[model samples]
Target: MNDHDYYRAFLHAVWHDRSADPLVASLLAQPAFAVYRNTIFKGCVDALAANYPAVQRLVGAQWFQGAALAYARRNMPQDASLIAYGDGFAAFLSGLEEASELPYLAGVAALDRCWTEAHLAADDAALDAAALHAALAAGQDVRLVPHAAARWRWEPAHPAYSIWSANREAVETPDELAWRAEGALLTRPVGEVRWQGIGPGACRFLDACGDGAGVAASAALALEAEPGLDVAAMLGALLQAGAFTSFH
Candidate 1:
């Protein structure tokens, strides 16, 4: 191996407590190596804590740190940028035995991940309602697409959206949150990310848009999914929220 490769191998062995390299086999047990290993693991834990602050806040720092440590040990970052780390952390939480008590924790963590994605998404001008109307009036077959910074999902089994929204920046939650499924829509309309809870129909409408449907078709699909849904209002809300961009 080259010098850089050997150096990385040495660090990996130290972190994993493996004698993978003959030259570094003896050094792995040394005190300095242990300190480096611990520091690296601590950094991983810290990144996870920052990435999933809602999870940490929900469970408290001590418990979150413990869980983070376990997650770090098994799932190291695949990229140099720690910001993109913890992609599967919500699934990891869902499988943990201790996490079973908090049925909505994994879903909350998933929304937290969505927020990060929307925040880091590329900048673009959102599609204005005027432009859409003009295109349709001109008889153009214009497909609508979600904005680059848009992220949304329909959690059909839990009130994940409500729980996540309430607990994202604050420790407080609703006094009596309805025990039902919810959906969420997140987008970077301006420079910062913004979010709002949506209904299943809205989620389906966004899905249809993502699947390359025209705005009218997407709204039709939404209404098909929910017969009583106010698709016009939903479309208006999404337009006002800067949820769509012209299809590329």
Candidate 2:
């Protein structure tokens, strides 16, 4: 094989298999090879920890580092940009036997990943709430468009939103609310990623908006999903949160 092919194979083995390829086995004896391997692996681990802070916080540093390294060994970054790494980490964690006890841990990691993505997403000008209201009053048929950076849908299988929020404050979650299913909405309305827990109705409404539905149609969908939901209040809350980038 050519030098480039050999090197690529070697790196794949070191990063994904956590071992030296037979072709590069001789180099493994060199201290520098070990150092290089450790450095690359550690970089992946650190990136994961940074991106999934809530997961790390829940599992504790040492445990998280171990888990991170394990995940790194199994999943190499698809892109060279470490910032975009760990897209499948939550799924990886969900499959781990070690994380079986904490089923919600994976969901928390997913939220943290969503937060990272929202933070790094491209900027967009949010539609002004007053202007949207004016358009509605004028009887214009406008559909609210979510910002490019918005993560308006994050409905985890487990009740992880509470755990993620609590991790931000380093506080213990109340037992009663710890495992209650929750949803989250993330948006970068003003250059800062902001997130909040959303109810089933609001989540449904946001989903409809994301699908390019108008305010009235989205509210109807929300009401269909949750009969007693206050559609007007939910729309107001979404508007106040700067969830829309423009009205179409």
Candidate 3:
């Protein structure tokens, strides 16, 4: 095999194999192989832990580490890069019978996935209120585009965010009774990712934008989806969240 092909194979074996393959053993001694193996495993564990902090909190550190190791062994990421690892983790959690008792766990995983997506998505200019007002004054039918990095989803649990926030230090089970499926928006504004729970109207509006609807059409859809929804308030919140890019 060519050098490139040989290196690729070595990487595959190092990442996926619990036992060192002959190809890897020939290149590095057994001690070197063991060290490299530990490094690769620890790297995967660290990445998973960083991405799924809330999950780690839900499951204690020891259990979380065990689960993460199992997941990494079973689903070694195809790409050497860890930019978007664990994309299928939510589904994986859903399929695991052990995690079946925590129904909200999968939802939390989904939220984390969205946060990852928002973090890596392409950057865009935020729509300013002054610009929007100017466009309105010009009688132009301008349509705001939601930021490419922005994402919104509903979780069937109240205080899910609170639970996630608390998980950083203490382990507290959220009150499922008081929790309703809460909708959240994730966006990067000024280079920092922010999560905000939005009202039904704002949620519908953002969804409409994602579906390629114009501003007026999205507003109408929001109104249809939620009666007594303040369109202005929704627009202002979107603006504040830096959720929109330029208008067409």
**Model 1 — TM-score against the truth?**
0.93
Native-referenced Cα lDDT, model 3: 0.78
Q: How many angstroms is residue 155 displaced in model 1 relative to the true structure, after the best TM-score fit?
A: 0.9
Q: Give me the candidate number with maximum lDDT.
A: 1
User: Tens digit of lDDT per residue, candidate 1, span 169-219?
Assistant: 685788898899899999899888899989889999899888888767877
> What is candidate 2's lDDT per residue for 31-130, written digit by digit as tens?
7877888899899999988898889889999999999988888888778889978999999898999999998888888888888989998888868888
| Model 3: worst 10 consecutive residues (lDDT sum) | 160-169
- Note the Cα lDDT for every prediction shown: 0.85, 0.82, 0.78
Candidate 3, superposed: residue stretches over 4 Å from native? 18-32, 78-84, 137-139, 156-159, 168-177
TM-score of 2: 0.88
Model 1: residues with Cα > 4 Å off, grouped in runs? 4-8, 138-141
TM-score of each model, in listed order: 0.93, 0.88, 0.82
lDDT at residue 26 of model 3 (Cα atoms): 71
lDDT by residue (1-248, candidate 3, tens digit) is 68997777787777665325566657565677778877888888888888888888788789878877877877777788987888888888888888877877777777788888998899898877797888877877677788988988766554555555456345675555366657788899888788887777788888888888877889898998779989988888888888988787
Instruction: Answer with 2 or 3, whichever has the higher TM-score.
Output: 2
- Identify the candidate with maximal TM-score: 1
Per TM-score, what order, best first? 1, 2, 3
